[model samples]
Target: MPKQMNFIVSKNSFEEFGMMVILGTTGAAMETQMNFFFTFWGIFQLKKGYKPGVAGMPFPFKKLGGAMFRKMLKGFGYDDMWEMVKDGVEEGKIKLYPCSMTMDLMRVKKKQLREICEEPVGAAAFLEMCDNADAVISL
Candidate 1:
């Protein structure tokens, strides 16, 4: 009976998608309940020890492009969605999960994701959370 819901975002945008996730989650936290399941392209941003460009390529052939894109974000004052989600967690009304299967496929270890994620769960488990949600969105 949560007032709000869970969102599943699977696309990779030029940080635009990332923007939406941050906005949506922040909105939910302010007014309703919320959870986010990051899968596929979404998982790239959820990696624990993962730093966007300092590590490996989160996106294919877009390393330099991605870095420059993030620099642009700095000017916009775009905040890190992961850290925002963490704040939501500390406030006790949010949960963020990094898809377990996606991690395996990408060769991303659990230890690598634990730092930022509330937990690493399967899609089905995530759907279970969605079941009672007022909305379940995939972007």
Candidate 2:
């Protein structure tokens, strides 16, 4: 079985976050501990009522792209992203942490984030948590 794995999520794109979730949950199924840290643009999608959009699409095309992306994911039998995260948390194998500094700098409040995320933590605290992780992947 794998040991602790840490993920530094720095983007809020479908490709990055979606793939991370897949790998993280696969590891979790093997009883690996998964720690995900959301920072910068990554933290925004963790908020409630957030709709995911394809990264780097023209403003007018983003909505359409997101729709197409969701359809593709659904074809692959994947549930909504938030639902998957909630499942991982409820299964007790994954923990999500939002960067406190990111939130502060972006003027985002803790209450705005989903409850599945743990209490926000600074980069130092997150680094400490990663000290023993077998792998640290940045996405």
Q: Write the per-residue lDDT of candidate 1 for residues 53-115, one digit (tens) a residue.
A: 422345564557666766786688867655656676766677677888888877877776646
TM-score of each prediction? 0.71, 0.90
**Pairs in steric clash, model 1:** none
User: What do the candidate models score in CA lDDT, each in turn?
Assistant: 0.66, 0.83
When superposed on Cα atoms, how far off is each prediction in RMSD?
4.3, 1.7
Pairs that clash in candidate 2: none
lDDT of 2 at 101: 93
Give per-residue CA lDDT, model 2, range 35-110, as digits (tens): 9999998898688887667777888777688778888989999887677767778987899999999999878899
| Model 1 lowest lDDT segment of ten | 49-58
Specify the highest-lDDT model's number. Answer: 2
Q: Assess candidate 2 and give its TM-score to the true structure.
A: 0.90
